[model samples]
Target: MPGPPILTSPPKASPGDRVAVLSPSFAAPGFAPAVHEQAMARLADLTGLTPVEYPTTRRLGASARDRAADLNSAFADPEMRAVLATIGGEDQITVVPHLDPTLILSDPKPFLGYSDNTNLLCWLWTHGVAGFYGGSTQVHLGPGPHVDEVHARSLRAALLTGERLEVTDPDESEDVGRDWLDPRALHEFGDREATEPWEWAGPPKSVTGRTWGGCIDVLQWILTAGRFPADPSVLSGGILLLETSEELIPATEFGWIVRSLGERGLLEAVDAVVVARPPASSLEVRPTKQACAAHRQEQRDVAIETIGRYNPDAVVVVGVPFGHTRPQWILPYGGSMTVDGVSRRIWADYA
Candidate 1:
């Protein structure tokens, strides 16, 4: 199969523009109406854009075809200048195949989402359209005391202004979050742990390329569905942006996933890899602080080791501010990014 084109960043949405907020995956809004409303309010407050919902935006258990139709309508509507997912979900892969590429191509707008939304982002990338990789309405905008400055700035750049921005590591980060069902979820943000400085390995050099990759498990699903490029060479010189989700796969399993990528020749093809800090604890797991720390360390070790096995020359940076964590950084999926191992700096071209 032919490689994906050098995707173009779609037209940015201006203030006062109507941005379609849809639940392409899970109907998060259905379960957390307060959170969803707060998110819409936050989006308007932060970006000066109007949040318009689609037919299936808050309809719980909507079929894949219905979700795809909502997405199609969002993309096709001339009034909808951008599209944002309410939140990520596990079965977005089912919804992707139902989408009509013609609709997206005819009126490509800034599509913002991450995690399970990776499926749609990759789909758009395959069709030569770039999207922002981290902007869930409920997760980032709602439920917190305030929208994170880093997240707000990145979202602003992606939506209102097409400007290049530096991706910085947050001083503190959190994996655990408040329960959406709890009344406190409207304004309370859970505890955060002190973050470590990003660790860099491999060749002490800088490389710039289009960004690719997303939540590792979601990417694995996409790969399993054969949605990614058939030829790994297409990703040559690209920066691999990967992170684990709340599920928090074991270190051995994570290694196996990375190894599988290597086997498919993806690791050797990319110039650099940026692994977001894995969420070490979750409501379900609820590990102790020490255990969380240990889990994170093990994840980092396995990632570095696995990448070294396949491509020792490739630059690998760990502890990026993205993924299923608080204080997330919104990155341009398929957009350009610079990874400087020697200087230990990262810059993304949001434009």
Candidate 2:
């Protein structure tokens, strides 16, 4: 297990290049064609890149092998310069084993996704390819009044510009958007609320290192499947990126997961830890505003306290918008990020 120099960022995509818009996990585009089509249009308009779909990109419940074949085709094609997931799903772990690593190695491209897509990102990371951790056309580019400024900027940085950008607070966020079946889902943003300033903890020092980790639930599955490095030291001096999805698991469960990582020698191996603003409500589980605030706060407290118990010197920041939340920042999965505790700011290198 190696670090840093092992995984390299693939060549950035240029304007007019073709990007594979894939649904390797769940065929979200198939369920909501209107939103999906709008997302594709916006993706083209924002980055000046064409969105190319594969055979399984819009075929709901496609077999894992079929999805992998689509992914293989995308990576093998000389015309495809990057790959983006339509949205995250539950069973990408099954899809990863079927992928053709030879094709990915021969023609590595910028792969952007989050949530269950973490499985593929981690797979690529282990194979010496870096990927972007957030970008889902179904969730971010579609269903909103417009593409979020932060999301649009990060999408461009990841796919087209290859520039370093600060990950800033978007000031407002939504736990989950409207149901895809709703006609309003095409243009209206979800119920959004004011966001608190990101909470920072640990020593007042700065650290810049490659990032790993993703949706905590999916990360647990990855660990259970033995997909992570056998040598925890491979993550030494790196940054840990953690976030939760719309399932809205309890704060206690979140603590237990982080505790497991610390027990595995992962906590002390990292120089910094970043936790996304966990989703507190969902379409069928909307809580009152006060309850939502409390849930987020409790999760934040447990993250800081648990990380401190294992590595008090590790710089920790909670509630940066990424992962399942709206206004997400497409951070690098295996690329460099600067977490400055003194200034309380974050910068990601898309190159």
Candidate 3:
């Protein structure tokens, strides 16, 4: 089958434009109003864009159809320039089927999210619409004392200013943050530690391609549900984005998932693979700093070995901060990304 049509970033949002904030997966904002409110205020102050929330945005346990209604309405509205997910959750797979492709295809706009939001992103990709792969009001904007600089830069790049920006290591990260119910969750970050440099593998040549893929766990569900392309060639020459969520699946499991992609011809179809820094700890279980480091290293090794088996020439960069981690760098989904092994740098084009 032919590859997807060339995807384009939606028109950039102006300072005073309205952006929809919807909870298409889980209504995290409803559960933690304080964090959600703070995120809203910060969003307006930072970008000068108005955040318009739909009824289901704050209505927890909303049916998938109801959530899809909000999304459809947002896309159909002439004034809404962009749509943002409150956060990722388990049920977006159900929500995606209810979405009206005509609404999105008619006015394709940037939708920023990751994790479970990958379902929507993948759905949007199928229709040839581009979106950002990271950004969560509940996770990145609300709980921290402030939005991390890397996040702020990429957020603007995705929304207000369409520009090419280097994807950088923030040099520190946290696996998870304070409990949402805790009052301190409003002004504090979770336990954070210094980060290690990203590990580069495969050939030394630089490769640039439009990006595809998302949280590996979510990709599994998408594939099992028959939502992905019947022909892996749709991803031909694209950069594959891969990351695990806070569930902290074992390195072996990650390898298994990649192995499946390899069997399906996806691993060999891509020119490069970009792996986000996987979160190694969660609220219920916090490992020692040393243990966390070891855990990340294990995943890094598995990713390198598995991808190499399928495509030894595929450029691989592991442990870049983009998904399921604090200080996350929101990257382009279905937009241009350059993985330069020679320069040891990465660049994402929000345009």
User: What would you estimate as the lDDT of candidate 1?
Assistant: 0.91
TM-score of each: 0.98, 0.98, 0.99
Q: Which stretches of candidate 1 lie over 4 Å from their true place?
A: 1-4
Stretches > 4 Å off in candidate 3? none
Q: Write the per-residue lDDT of candidate 2 for residues 1-351, one digit (tens) a residue.
A: 554448878998889999999999999999999999999999999999999999999999999999999999999999999999999999999999999898989988999999999999999988989999999999999887899999999999999888999999999999888899898998899999899999999999999999999999999999999998887888989999999998899999999999999999999999999999999999999899999999999999999999999999999999999999998899999999999999999999999
Backbone N/Cα/C clashes per model:
0, 0, 0
Candidate 3 has what TM-score? 0.99
Model 3 gets an lDDT of: 0.93
Compose the digit string of candidate 1's lDDT tens values, residues 1-351. 444366878888888999999998999999989999999999999999999999899999999999999999889999999999989989999998889999888988999999999999999999989998999998999987999999999999999998888899879998877999999888788888899878889999999999889999988999999998789988988999989999989989999999999999999999999999889988888899899888988889999999999999899999999978889999989999999998899998888
Over the stretch 8-65, how does candidate 3's per-residue lDDT look in tens digits?
6799999999999999899999999999999999999989999999999999899999
Model 1 TM-score, 2 decimals:
0.98
By summed lDDT, the worst window of 10 consecutive residues in model 3 runs over 1-10
Instruction: Please name the candidate that would achieve the greatest lDDT relative to the true structure.
Output: 2
